[model samples]
Target: MLDYSLDISAVERDLALPDLVAEGEELDALVSAEADWTQPTPAQGWTIAHQIAHLAAADANALIAIRTPEAFDTVLKQREAAGPHSADLEADAGAAKPRSVLLEQWREGRTELAAALRDIPLDRPFPWFGSDVTATLTVALRLMETWAHGQDIYDTLGVPHPPTTRLRHVASLGVAGIPLSFYAAQLPIPTVPFRVELTGPEGQTWVWGPEDAEQQVQGPALDFCLRVTQRRPLSDTALQATGADARKWLEIARVFL
Candidate 1:
């Protein structure tokens, strides 16, 4: 098995939750201001309204999970049941209603979720995706997911996504998890040490592996995260994997099932 001991403490310490909250609010505003009611997002048949509703439902579930770890499955089921509400919200997209109402719901949901996360003790364990994870790690993953899915919504809206400095959490997590996918794909392990360098949106460089290395990958962090998450194809970016093993790892990059 690949080692899961990659140090992410620095990455976690540098995360700015306030910035994530602000960006999420900005996305909510954009969703509210959208004029097209029939436009579809990349997520199957979901519209912007459905997206917002899903985010709201997810946030609510996160709040529950943060408060009572033993209730994780029940919270997930509740969130799943809210899918019909999301559909209904999307169906009313063209209705003549005050946009502020929808925005308020989104804001409230996010605020509650943030408060729950902030109140959770970092050392506390929570059930997550069939495993027990620390409260801090769970929150970090949630933030990463929110930013990535927000990007999808932004792409559908034809708006430029602002620089995602907070996305470093996702990038680091993705990079650390790449080795597992490589092993699962039955690819040969590299004989030499290698380096991986991802340049973030705000000119921040994220480097993994070794400094003096025999193999390397260097490129944009956003693109790297997208590729590793299987949200974007490797050919869509400027990322370069120099060694055979490094290239193989990229071919099967995945963070979750």
Candidate 2:
């Protein structure tokens, strides 16, 4: 009956900073010349521009959710009125803008997000995907989102996935989502817990789950992120899972809200 939510303990002051920098600069570089905005990305039916626009949309939304709840409510209402494909509508609208304009929007949005995150109190609850969570937690969640979407953009263009210490943030989110993942899959929550040991990019080992549990997953931190986000097939990675519960979690792992 214990809550398995991962304790960040230390919120990387400006958790989204590095990933934001990397993502923006990389995308900037990708379009340095007369680039192809229409190039397809890993996200189904979305082009590279759509991918970045979605991130921009998310960044702006995060800012609203963190600093202006009323504005966030308006957004939720607009999306509700627009119906199920509202997300697509938003992204497409963003993507439809001139490439230069769209890029500026993403850049400016992230810049403001950085400032908003700096002053946001940790204890203040904000409406996230389905429930209210603290601003500190939302930072890590945003970092994970930025990183995961970066994957789709890179994989779409055959670029190598960016490796960074920031991944510990995402790996933590993934490990924390095991219960929710099970709940969404309509599967029984595992009565027996498991352990997760990921060797991060900086050679730091990240540990999660219950230490004494019989089930365990261990491998490179990047692979852990890939699996949790379903950005890549497990068969393509080197993560090793021991015990039925651990293996099943890997087969159906997902952490996004």
Q: Pick the candidate with the highest TM-score.
A: 2
157-232 in candidate 1: lDDT tens per residue?
7898766777677776776666567666776655566688999998988888888776788999888888876778
Across 1-257, the per-residue lDDT of candidate 2 in tens digits comes to 11323466465556555665665566566654437889887787788788778889988888888887867878878877998788788889898998999888888898788777777776677765556766567667767877787788777677776688878888877887787678778899897777999999989888876888899999999999998988989998899999988998898888853
Q: List the residue pairs that clash in candidate 1.
A: none
Which stretches in model 1 have alpha-carbon errors above 4 Å? 1-6, 75-104, 183-194, 213-215
- TM-score of each prediction: 0.78, 0.89
Model 2 stretches astray by more than 4 angstroms: 1-6, 12-28, 31-34
Q: Model 2: how far is 170 from its true place, Å? A: 0.9
